[model samples]
Target: MYTHTKKPTGLCIELLESQGGLISLEDFHELWSMLRKTHSLDHLYPLPTDTEEFHLLYIIISRDQEHGDLGIHANGYGIEDEGKYRLAGFACLVVPPNERREKSILSGNPNGICDTADIRIALLPAVQKRGFGRFVVHELLGHAFDTLRIRRVTASVVSPVRPSHSAAQKKQIGFNTKQICRIFETFGFKFEGISRGAVMNTEAPEDDKPVWHDVHRMSMLVTDYFEEHIISSLSTIRSPCHKLPLKTVRLSPWDTMIQRQEEEKRDLKLWAEAPKDTLANDACDEDGENSDVETMLGDDDVDEHDWDMANDFDD
Candidate 1:
């Protein structure tokens, strides 16, 4: 639903003209093609559309102009000539407004991307370690704060130590441990806990062979708080052997007792119904015998008189 109505190109918001830079849909297509050619993922799904990803490229270019993302991504980043751009880097920028997770608690930041201007850049694989990834992110965050008139930004990426991944193993593509850490440090993104229910893999798949694992989710934010404490806070574990937190819910004894009592009562009632039902059926048989005795009185005809005479004679 996003249109290519406005876009910015080049570096420095101050250097931008009164109307700012504009990119045509054609330009976006060119960028998209370049990204595909660079990454060799022209066949991947859940990635941006050929025509669609350019819209995101538009946002990245616009924000990058003002150094918005740059303030956040600092490490392993080098500026292109005149701060224009670092070559040999690519990512499909996306808004994915509806696809974000539980960011409702983050009221100060909107849309879960951190700031209204906050832009998320998915780094292109071909240009990852060379530092263009950090540079692009830094520019995006800086522009979001300055030109876009926003406070901060947020971003996330998959963890390297994921449980399983058929695609990653199949594609021979997994996260870069050092690079991922570098990107977060550069962008002021913080480490939140791993989502417990997050699926790292699927045993069965629709189109392909059974997947053995899935990707892990990690979150980030662009803030002074994260910037000041990111390094120190990151060192909280100090070693890579940090233990995972887990909780177990125990069943209440009252519930167990109530369930046991109900079952016992039900069984007892079923057993108790047998004798009462048989005794009632026997009484019905005795009533039939009494009816037969009345039939024998047909010859006597005077039932009450006969009963009185018979009783007096018997005495």
Candidate 2:
């Protein structure tokens, strides 16, 4: 069902250059705006008001393969030129990967384990079911699990402004609603739960925050990836993971915890043996040891200080 977008049937997907440096912030605003209209999404990252700090977010753009003319649609979506490029699908990974609102993920831990990826994908209305959605999702997960070596991937289902169609998407009257869910499920994505109006609970009351209409939370594990077609794309593109050794080195969580405990105890012992003034001077030395980790990697509002504040935030 995937439409051929000038992309050869077997070539690896090119990780569109990072939007921060290669693409302008304005381009992303245009892209998010274009997707919001079609997907009925209420908000998009680097929100318009967030116009200044666009560099904080990462963007991936996937062009839809046009069917009839085999020409991409221009002005119809986010693609700059019509016949040359059409915005078929995209996934945005907002940073820093963890916000203060999410501390269980980033509290004094290796973020590679907390490498959470949020994706918001949309295809032009004209090219819904030619099988493009399935292929795109496969590629996204393939990259997340294999190429980029992301720890997990998550995306929320977006509903249209009005009733569009029934499930299964057998007809051509409306958008393909199940495509998003089915694509992830096919790759073994698990349904975490709903957020805001996750299901029929769209009308239900939320605690403290205003009630939202519809949002479904779904996630997938990102290791031991097995989609051949997508994997082929990675090989062709030479993603970063291609350079990593093929063998996976699995580690025991229990062993890791024990090591951390020993290290923390060692630090505590050091403090007990040192005088108060020595401890103050040692603090200066500690800065040199922790200089590499003073700030969060992919986000602005989430540093170590914010992480502590996050612990106090009501879940």
Q: Candidate 2: deviation at residue 261, Å?
A: 47
Question: So what's the TM-score on candidate 1?
Answer: 0.36
Model 1 agreement with the true structure over 24-137: per-residue lDDT tens digits: 344434554655555433212234334322223422331233422221221122334344442222343333333232364355444344243223344344333444444555
Record all residue pairs in model 2 with backbone atoms less than 3 Å apart, i.e. clashing: 1-130, 1-131, 2-131, 2-132, 12-233, 64-88, 95-299, 96-298, 96-299
Candidate 1 residue 240 Cα shift, in angstroms, is 36
Angstrom error of the Cα, residue 133, model 2: value is 3.7
Q: Root-mean-square deviation of each candidate, in angstroms?
A: 19.4, 25.5
lDDT of model 1 at position 314:
68
Give the per-residue Cα lDDT of candidate 2 at 43: 27
Instruction: Tell me the RMSD of model 2 versus the true structure.
Output: 25.5
Which 10-residue span in candidate 1 carries the lowest summed lDDT? Answer: 10-19
